[model samples]
Target: MRALQSDGAAVVHRDERAEGFVLLSPQFKQRWRFVTAHMGNLHAVLDLAKVADTLLFVLDPLDGWDSTGDYYLSCLFAQGLPSYALAVLGVPDLPQKKQADAKKKLGKAIEKRFPDAKLFPLNTEQESLLLLRHLAAQKQRHLAFRDRRAYLLAHNAEFVPSRDSDLVGNLKVSGYVRGWTLNVNSLVHIVGHGDFQMSQVDAPPDPFTLNPRVAKGQQKKGQDMEIQVSICPHSQQSASVLMQPRKQQPLQSEVIPDPMEGEQTWPTEEELKDAEGSLKKRRKVLKVPKGTSNYQAAWIVDDGEDGSEEEEEDDNMEDEDLMEEASQVVESSEEEELAEEECETMTIAESARDDLYDEKVDEDEEQMLEKYRQERLDQMFPDEVDTPRNLPARVRFQKYRGLKSFRTSPWDPKENLPRDYARIFQFQDFSRTRKHVFRQLEKEETEGAMVGWYVTLHICSVPISVMESFRQGMPMVLFSLLPHEQKMSVLNFVVRRHLGNSDTVKAKEELIFHCGFRRFRASPLYSQHSSADKHKLEHFLRPDAALVATVYAPIAFPPASVLLFKQRSNGMHDLIATGSLLSVDPDRIIIKRLVLSGHPFKIFSKTAVVRYMFFNREDVLWFKPVELRTKWGRRGHITEPLGTHGHMKCHFDGQLKSQDTVLLNLYKRVFPKWTYDPHVPEPVPWARNEQQLFMQELEME
Candidate 1:
């Protein structure tokens, strides 16, 4: 270790906040870049790891890793670990008799987290050299999503504000372009900021190697990258920029909504003539439901058997149903008004009782207990919402309909879609389009800097404050976006709830998602991760198995790993789930299942009378076709309505048990809430530097 330092490796960047080194020396086999920071500063670690190809963990011999180490390990593992090397420090200091036992215990613990990797002692210079060799020889695991895009790790960052506005400026960021060749015509995304366009890219000389041809005291080019970063003074803000682009990349995050879409529009003159001709010709049509033909329908029937009487009967029945519906609606409004008054009085009484006690309540404890209670109730009665007492059963569950078989039933994805769907872009055939785009990118000539080149990018209109973060140890990353990647689409991820976390993760709960290089906040709906046509919505993120998370987000191709995190009150992020992208499928159907329960009032031979399932005879008749089951496994269907009061005569396969409960399963297609935000503020640093002041503060407490 001392000999290597004597040889002198170049430090690409160094400051009070961060220190970076690029090993271009002849002693190393491959180029190596190292960035060191306190693990307590999570922002620095997460940003750096996204572009880093390998991770080296240095550990103590006696205590390999404390609680803090374990926390970081879990985060790294959840975020998809790159090639890693584990080096045990200070093995020579330990007593000879205890060294073997120490290594055995450490190996056991290491095996659980890193099954194939082994520990190396870093006490001797020879051991250190061997570890580096192993790292260089190890096969680099290529991540799918990142492999298709171009990104860079900035070694130098400088901002030159525009003459008009100090807030916006041309930020110069220089680094080695990795992955695919970067197209200057594309948009670049920074870590914290949303997206910006690069004005131009300048070919910079290799900062790692000194050029003998350049004269002394030349300011334009320098061998030291860090020294070149602070080239211009504050007073002299003007700096020479290369040729800028003639046009800018379009910033289109969503599809433009059409006001006339899905609405009646004026017909054309040709279409009016066609309509008149169609009205003149009377064509016999056999119509059932919009999509309900198991076999076929006979459109042409004998003129004598034209079914004229059947049509009259159907029209009369529809009229009577509409009249009954209008009367029930009036009654419901009156009942709802009375219910609201009772709720107001109850709230006032509760507040009056609260005035008796002083407000020293532990809100955190109370919230935790409430969360646990809700979770327990959900497990016992999954997806159970209180039955409305003010509204009719038919009106209350209008959006919901019963399914014969929850697994095999066909659901139309385009039916009953929310208005938000209009704002998103949908691919006609996602798989075919994905393949075509990649093939085109491969054949097209890249417009900007090629990969492995050290180029300076002048990103226009970047906030001056955003550039300062780079100097403060927050690693600023820049990645180019692919074609159509900015448009919003339905994204699915196959993720399993992290076993280390026990907090119940509910469906549609706001969570921070890290998809490879992108981080965003979304409340996603979870479904079964199977390849089935229809998937049942899960109330809880089950830790025992993997599930699919459906969210409306910017379209990112699969092969990218996913990490789900929940933010805590103390400003720390807890890892919830980890997985990879499943697909970008807008047609995937996610149905929320609701269970309605009622008790049997009377039991008879192969027949039973049920109550409390409906409020009137109309609702019983409306849902007569829906199949019913019991807790004891008896299957039945409603035969007839007993009376106006909610009682119904049902026929089961066998004798009904008086104590058994009757259950009905209803389903409705649910969409994720439109709560996607791409920006995540940096969290406060918790521990590093051995926690000197923090440890003292803790001891004082």
Candidate 2:
């Protein structure tokens, strides 16, 4: 109240002393001005446009019940009034932890909408008077910035329009001035009773600037006529005037008047003290009144003390006697009321017990309902050992469900399924059934290229997880894209099962072989024989078979026959003579050496001999000379191919082969240690002799 008066403003609050009239400060009383009736209304927010230069709304978060800080702040924004929030007093105590979060959320919400608006968190010790003083100083500087600015006064109190007021024309502003990003820096100053007039003005300078006022040294931007702030300064003296400390002021006090009415009221200290004393006594007398209605206490206060001070003395004696009668009557009535209340409560308890009994009876009814439900289920689904296909769809689907349930169920198995039903649904090739599928997938020992394709297979009821696991186990074969025929063919070879009605195991479909294509040919045969070729006939007829074959082993085959030699980079030549019969055993390669070309010898070992070169497959007679070129003299090492080259020359720096005849001393040679499995197939017949020779040369150790 003091701060508003200092700012030449007025405030109002409801009062009973003045009846319809409001009270205000001494300064307003001297001018005969009071705050408006609208301002005095507690429910109404003060129309700040008719009050002071800047509006400050001090929001008490705790004042309202269960207030969401966000909601309260948003209401201020919705009003569309350019008002500021004084938040320094701190948040109100909320029922839950959400209040703290709500406070921060509300701050962010305000920042989004009113980015430039100032928010001050006033310290708890500070009051509105201190804040208002600071704002008044700020407004003084704001007015100094604009030249030719007019001041408006309503009922002797300074008034400023809200930011939304259109009358405040856009002022040419530079940078963030006056401690704010000035949106509209000047207003069309219109004041007085009958007619309003406007005058142009320049906006204020930044409040943080050193030279805020338009003084002598500074040149004026336009016509130099500074708008002075009409402020009513605080009149009370400082601490020097007070002899001792005074009581702290309460925040909320009744505003006596709204200045819009031009009336003022300021009460003397003595008069306020008398009112407080009388009110205290009245409350004490009414504290424990005798009454069941609660109406008798009010009648006592009004009737007993209604008259003036002189009439009150005359009734003082009557007051004590009246009080005794009132207490006795009230006590007697309370005892009677208590007895009636107890009876009513007993009736309610009995009603509740009856209700509980009825609820138990209802529970019995539900059990009967459930019993009927079970009977219906049993009748609809009678147990049958064998269900016919000609039965209803429901029965058929149910029977199928039952059969499938038993297949994977944890129950005891019934006897074998009916013979007729099994025969009808039975697999022709039971190799594709679940039992055989799992069995076939586990088998490993197989021959040939270890390759087979299924020709016809259709999968229906298989666990997805099982199928996925099976696919992962087979690394080399990606059977996802293979034809069904190929999968069935492979499964048939691997998996086997007995037929439903027979004992025979199933087999895969046969494969077709193509031999030759021919036109008209000669009838009789003409024969010519060379002596060298005749001797080579033994190799082509019953040649040797070798067990162990080294990876990437090469054979040498001449035009007459095939010969195997273990050729080494170190020029240590060894041979298993041609026409030697070599065979694979369980632990080693068995060789039968025949004296066809080289020395006849037998090699029973774990390692294989490289015996033959190209004959039936491709080129038969071509010999390229070995080229020798190197400074290291490391004997034999093949060079990488040159550009556009066809064949790499075997550059034997040592004089050995231009298809030269070389003999292997089979008795003196060394071989690497490697075991051979005889179950694996042998090389082609003609190449067998060559391989035997090579093994003899490189004898297995």
RMSD of each: 9.7, 58.5
Candidate 2: segments with Cα more than 4 A from true spot = 1-51, 60-85, 88-90, 95-98, 116-118, 121-123, 127-149, 156-701
> Candidate 2 residues 304-355, lDDT tens each?
3222353234223343343355346547866997897566421224544464
Residue 348, model 1, lDDT:
27
Candidate 1 wrong stretches, greater than 4 Å: 1-3, 6-17, 94-102, 118-128, 135-138, 210-248, 265-374, 445-447, 685-701
lDDT tens readout by residue for model 1, 1-701: 23222122333333444565655333553557677756877667777777878888877787678777787787777676777888887676789998888888788878888889878777665776677667768888765767768999888888998999998889989888988888777888896677788878777555554311333474344343222322223214433343467666777888788878789779999999999899669545564435433232221123333223532342233334443554585488679978975664212245434652463444665575566567667878777765566788888889998877877777888898888998898989988888998898888876667777778898888887787777777788888988778789899999997876666687889898888788899999999878788888887799888999989888887678888988766677777898998999888998888877777765666677777677678888777778899889998777666657566777677777888988888889888889999877666654333333432343234
Q: Each candidate's TM vs. the true structure?
A: 0.78, 0.16
Per-model clash counts, in order, read 0, 52
